[model samples]
Target: MTTLPAPLVWTFDGPFERCLADIEDTLRRAIVMVGDVSRVAMLIDLSLPALKQRVDAGEALQPAWGRFLERMARYGLPASPRVRHLRGAGPLATLVIAYRN
Candidate 1:
């Protein structure tokens, strides 16, 4: 029997590009720490209201999100990550992502 490492959780509340950079750095460090990138699984948590606000504010979140996923794929992670939306979280937008094996 093999036990998996604890999941790596990250919270983002800023521009999409910075978020992507942070996530990318986290993934790189995690992969190096685990020494096996293939066993990693990613979970992305997005706020529905926040996303809508971004769109209403004239920010292209959808396309940016898509591009972020594409960047993750380049690191050998899954392009299609599991996502969950939380309601009544508040006005501040937050993106939470978890990587696990």
Candidate 2:
């Protein structure tokens, strides 16, 4: 039996745009550490209210999100990542969990 490494987790609580660079960097590092991108799975948690507010205020999230997906694809991660929005009240928060699947 082989032992797998623990998941890589990252939590972002700020403007979505501001954290893109950091998020990409983290993904890159994770790919390097795991040695196999296909074995990785990602979970993203975003504050519902904050996201609504941004959308209501005419902020476009699709472009940024597209870029993120592109980065993941480039890193050999899955193109279709599972997204679940949970009810919550707080500032913008993005949680990413990457682990061997």
Candidate 3:
């Protein structure tokens, strides 16, 4: 019997607006790297409200995540992003990505 490791998830906790940039940067790198691989298959779970607070704070969520989503879509991979609104939190963000080879 063998065990498989869970997919990689980047957690940039702290502040949404303040940490949005960092999340974008991290996701970009992962997407680029995974896209270049021989077998292009990846999974991402961005279902945390805390992760989206920054963009949801009147920051045009679509444009904010446009590049990364476009890249993932172009690569023909499945990116499941779960975004929601939550009250209370000071500029905290996080990015989580999963890939399978």
Candidate 4:
């Protein structure tokens, strides 16, 4: 019989340490705000410009993609204390995580 807060969204511009840090921070904050009854929805994808820029900056998509998936594996993406990846967007390597805490 209570209304929940609106969903929190975190967008990553690049797959850099700083950007990833921001995402972790935001996700944590959302969990805290919602507590054991929080509902969350996340959409992480590679923008065209961002994708091209990283490649131009000498960042390969495979390695970067691997880095992301590796982090998910380490943190247990589909489990507690981690974001749950709901659906596969495409070969574009989008990570859309949704869950309720």
Best by lDDT: 2
Question: Which sequence of candidate numbers ranks them by lDDT, best first?
Answer: 2, 1, 4, 3
For candidate 3, the 10 contiguous residues with the lowest summed lDDT are: 38-47
Best by TM-score: 2
- lDDT string for model 1 (27-78, tens) is 6886776667776776666667766666677777667767877877787764
User: Which residues of candidate 3, in runs, are more than 4 Å off?
Assistant: 1-6, 36-80, 84-91
Task: Tell me each candidate's TM-score.
Answer: 0.69, 0.71, 0.42, 0.51
- In order, candidate lDDTs are 0.63, 0.69, 0.49, 0.51
Error of 4 at 58 (Å): 1.5
For candidate 2, the lDDT comes to 0.69
RMSD of 4: 6.2
Clash tally, candidates in order: 0, 0, 5, 0
Better of 1 and 3 by TM-score: 1
In angstroms, the error of model 2 at 74 is 1.2
Which portions of model 2 show Cα errors greater than 4 Å?
A: 1-5, 56-58
lDDT of 2 by residue, 1-101 (tens): 45545666676656667566677777677766777878777766677987788778787787888888776677666645566686796656554656655
- Ranking under TM-score, best-scoring first? 2, 1, 4, 3
What's the lDDT for candidate 3?
Answer: 0.49
